[model samples]
Target: MQVEVISSVNEACSGKLQHRTAIVVDVLRATTTIATALAAGASCVIPAETVQDAKQLTKEGDLAGGDRFCRQISGFSYGNSPGQYRGKQIEGKRIILTTSNGTRALCKAMRADHIIAASLLNAEACAQLAWELRRDVVILCAGSRDSFALEDGLCAGLLVHCLRQHDRSGMLQVDDFGSAMEALYRNKANVIMETLAQSQTGKKLLRLGQREDIVSCSQINVLQAVPYLNGGSLIQRLPGTIAQTAAPLC
Candidate 1:
């Protein structure tokens, strides 16, 4: 059905997402990092809206990682870089994550019936899963610092475009921002990686000497992981499957 794109957590909070499917986008890093972590075999990711929350969520064998405004938070085990989460070292461990915007957005949309983490890395998989659920979808972008972020919007656009391709019924109702984002994705499809590298968040990371992270996070459709919030954790699932053991929470 219906498709809408929320530019910020504030926008999401002003509306009702309860019982609806939400795909949260933070393409510059957070969502991309989470998907990469899962693909690398991290057991699950627990998003914390604040550093305090992240510290509280950490337990034995759990890794505490996150950033604030693209800088690694003091005492964090790792920053929100997808490259830092590869290989078997992080396997089977829980990640307590806190971010400048993404985790806060996740917390704000916790009431949604379904919440999937989306990045350029897992856009297609997320769209396919949302289509299968047959629920109204909200593409909620974790905009940087309460403002709209280009990378997140572009990823939302990609999700919308993929959803439109899968819907043969011609009933995909897209709101104004959704249409703009879809067009943005289509228009910039040719130089997406380059464009993302030049985005605000991308540039910020670069100034922080994290250019490799930008390149890694900008990779498109390299992961099939679809991480969703369930039972106080974000668990990875296939396009058509879900976490059966998850308990409902909002």
Candidate 2:
């Protein structure tokens, strides 16, 4: 039940996460979008590290979505906005997704014992899942480029808080990044939304007139699904079900 937070994919690779449960966070949009999409009934999501890869998947007849910074790609069917997933007929469909930071972080965690994608949208669910597993956990934040993002850090803090509540013994270990995130959570109430409106990436979205996207991504725990990478596709773990199906790669 040790807990640690890595600021980026690079930091995660430098540590030992092979036997640990990995939680990938990209609160600015990507992970948030995935959680929202799955909650809205998407069958599965295929996360690609690059927009080019996502486009290629789409050209091969995959249902693809693309986002760089914040705006939609030229030929993408959907942008990275969580609001676009509601009531859509995504059930049993494969979503080829690419994003600025989150996808890369997810790819890096693919080798972990258990990899779960997290965001403000599914923070509590993810934390609860991690606690249930009772494994050492690494919270990886997909920061902008190689730098830290405040929104992701805040989400990590919320997760840490949740996990601590579930197990308050000395079993939980907090790293430097985790401590910083907890501090941010103490001072900044609802900072994920505010940071997105003012962050470098968030400002780019605003310039693109995607204020609605920021608002959508900023909403916390709106989804109950915990998306995990299984056999290379993102699938939701349904509650009360000991068995699950792996999403086929398109």
Candidate maximizing TM-score = 1
TM-score for candidate 1, residues paired by index: 0.94
Whole-model lDDT per candidate: 0.88, 0.80
What total of clashing residue pairs does each candidate reach? Answer: 0, 0
Q: lDDT per residue, candidate 1, 1-250, as tens digits?
A: 8898998877886356876799999887899989999999999999998889898889888999999888889998798988889988889989999999999888888888889999999999999988877678898999988889999989999999999999787888999999999999999988887888888888888888988987897778888879988887999989866445534321
| Regions of candidate 2 where Cα sits further than 4 Å from its true position | 59-61, 190-192, 238-250
The alpha-carbon root-mean-square deviation between model 1 and the true structure, to one decimal in Å, is: 3.2
Task: Please report the TM-score between candidate 2 and the true structure.
Answer: 0.89
My TM-score estimates for the predictions, one after another, are 0.94, 0.89
lDDT of 2 by residue, 1-250 (tens): 6788998766778356787889999987888888878877787899998877776665443568867766687878888887777675666577899987899999889767888999888888898877766568899989987888877888899898878877755567788879888888767765667876877777887888888888987887777789988987889974334334422211
